[model samples]
Target: MTLSELIAQFRTLAFDKVEPYLFDDDSVIGWLNEAVKEACIRGQLLHECDDVDICQIAIKAGQVKYPTHPQLYEITHASLELTSINGGKRTPVCLVSFEEMDKADRDWRDDQDKHRLDPYFLIQHDTYVRLSRPTDEIGVLHLEVYRLPHKMSNDDDVPEIHLAHHEHLIDWALHKAFGVPDSEVFDLNKSEMAEQRFTNYFGFRPDSDLRRITRHDVPHTVKPFWV
Candidate 1:
């Protein structure tokens, strides 16, 4: 829904349709935008691999580390874009841990081969990427990743997530609205209940126990088995 429509609906549901609202338009909009972010991360709803700004990284010769997109939650796949050097052949790279690389080759971090072309493994911390082999020349890294939602500001702006998930986002806004600290309208009980309902639908958000949990809610969906 558009922000205006959603805000109106929120007022109706929140019983704040009357003027001198317990929540201001700015507050409601902020809560709604927060809801969008919570839903996106909790559900992995904003799956992005197509946008160049999100998926493509510019490589510097001999530079092994690169920053990831700020909104990224997890990277599912990555590869060095090799079209220019290997005649359009892409080289798929493995995601590895620092410890795993150290165990395999203790001096791996030395990066002696500045001219190395093929990278075998990649080490990705949440916000950075380190290549097994540094590039001989400038290159590109293509990544497949799950990202967070953008915050909405204007009344006409609708969330980027699928419309099916929009209605449920209200639960998060409700949770936040009632969660205001020490305000006359703040009710801890209402906040907790709203949060519980939000959790039931979106499977928990940034905090409150189940935050780190991953979901495979549908049938035939297997748990992630990353190597």
Candidate 2:
């Protein structure tokens, strides 16, 4: 649904009279933005895999600042290559803690030839990835990063989550919108119900394997250990 539609739906749920809107546009937009951010963080709905450049010139000794996408929230997978060849096959780099990366750097400094094959990364300042060593050559780095779902800015904008999950967004917005009391009573029950509904939908069966698995896929008997 569009941002306007979501706002309208939220108003319907939170207000008795729609002819005279109780909430301003900015107020509704704020609630919607919060809802989208919460949903994106809680669920794995927005993700993208793209090639990024770790510029050779950007390298200082054995580290290069890994560029970040605007909407990036987390990096799921990353691969590095020394050549510009797009499909030559790339090896995945292991993400390690700062201590591990420091060790790798020390090892490289001691004997570059001995640890030349090891490539590791540490997130620096929560913005850039600091490589243990600079690239042997210059090329693009491929990354699979989870992104923050886009905020609804325009009325035409649709959410990044699947359409089936869109209702949860409205539920979250309504919960926040009605959290403050408009009358003597706080209306805590309604707000809590909306919050619960959004949580239920957001975390619904997150770990279940969606792939079709049948009995044929299971082993009927155990085989010998050696075999």
Candidate 3:
């Protein structure tokens, strides 16, 4: 839903549509943005909510530096392919860790010929990829990265989450909005209910399965404690 729609819905749910809105537009928008971030973090592990982008890194001969996206939160995979010298076919290059890359640099300094073929990389400063050996031939590096959710500023901007999960955002926004002291709508029960609903619907814990057991599932002797 649009930000305007979300605000309207939140107002309706909070009963704040008298004359002067208990929560202003900026406050609601801020709450909604917070809600989006919360939902994004909560659902980050779910593949259904992930967005895939194919980024191309241009390789220049004797250049080992390449910049990464500012919004990049995590890199799932990185693949490097070298273009054949004679325009034949692209060959895949092996990816190595920081330690391996450092070792490769040391080995190359000692004996360049032996380690020239081994191209390794490590993320530098969490912002750029540093390759161990300078590229002998031009190639492209493909990176599959997961980025943080985009914050909504305009009314028409849509959230990155699935439409089915949008209501959770509203619940979170309402929870936050009602918690504000100036709003004059301080209901701990409502706030807690919204939070619990969001967690029950989207939050997944390691012990969720064990926690799902009902009282009826317990033995007669253990029922009293569970109840």
Candidate 4:
């Protein structure tokens, strides 16, 4: 596409016409590419949630990595765009930002202790590599998303609302991106479909008892809460 056309497409995507798609496995790395590159330029992208921990890992080992939010947004957006044009379905997904990561502090700290650092650093990381592949191809995976204005509980906060709204747009864009099948999408309860598909894609597994204990005792656990 021409640069102007690309920019127009991006504008449509940025202005509530699209949503993000994410992966279940980091090793797949099918979604990384332009998103991470864009994030690197925007300064919102990070290699790891905690650079200090990544540094430590690098000191001990030869390589280290993490995820960035912008990259996730970019890949999910790109994936949806690719799929939409190529006749595939799109799913709603988001990158865990520092704040989103912070919300699940207990889980993250525990992961740090066990894995030596949290794996699946950010959505950005996934798209970074995927976008860079020489084949100029994108991967396909299952996704389910819902319509907007998610019902909130009495105590839900502002960030949650913003994230939810943005996520909804990303989902909408996925349909545009993938030519989502009318039969397979948005006919039944959207939220139910999202939850069902998400659970199916992510799967459910019990956390280890030892990991739970470590998660409870991780130092400076609240630091990320403010992020």
Top TM-score model: 1
The candidate that achieves the highest lDDT relative to the unseen native structure: 1
Residues 1-227 of candidate 1 have per-residue lDDT tens digits of 99999999889888999999989999999989988888877788878889898899998876888998898776778877655556756677777677667877999777568655545677777678888877766778888888888888898999999888888888888888888885677888888998898889888556523322221111345688879
TM-score of each: 0.84, 0.70, 0.64, 0.17
Reference-based lDDT, each prediction: 0.79, 0.62, 0.64, 0.29
Expressed as tens digits, the lDDT of each residue in 50-116 for candidate 2 is: 4343221133334456656556656666666554333546667665545444554656434444135
Error of 4 at 66 (Å): 5.6
Q: All candidates: CA RMSD in angstroms?
A: 5.6, 8.2, 10.9, 21.7
RMSD of 2: 8.2
- How do the candidates rank by lDDT, highest first? 1, 3, 2, 4
Model 3, global lDDT: 0.64
Candidate 2 wrong stretches, greater than 4 Å: 51-62, 84-89, 99-115, 121-125, 181-186, 204-227
Q: Number of clashes in every candidate structure?
A: 0, 0, 0, 25
Off by over 4 Å in 1: 83-85, 115-119, 206-227
Q: Write the per-residue lDDT of candidate 4 for residues 84-198, one digit (tens) a residue.
A: 2335443322334444456666355334332231222332332222111111234332222111221222222121222222223222233233333445333344434533443
lDDT of 2 at 147: 71
Error of 3 at 87 (Å): 5.8
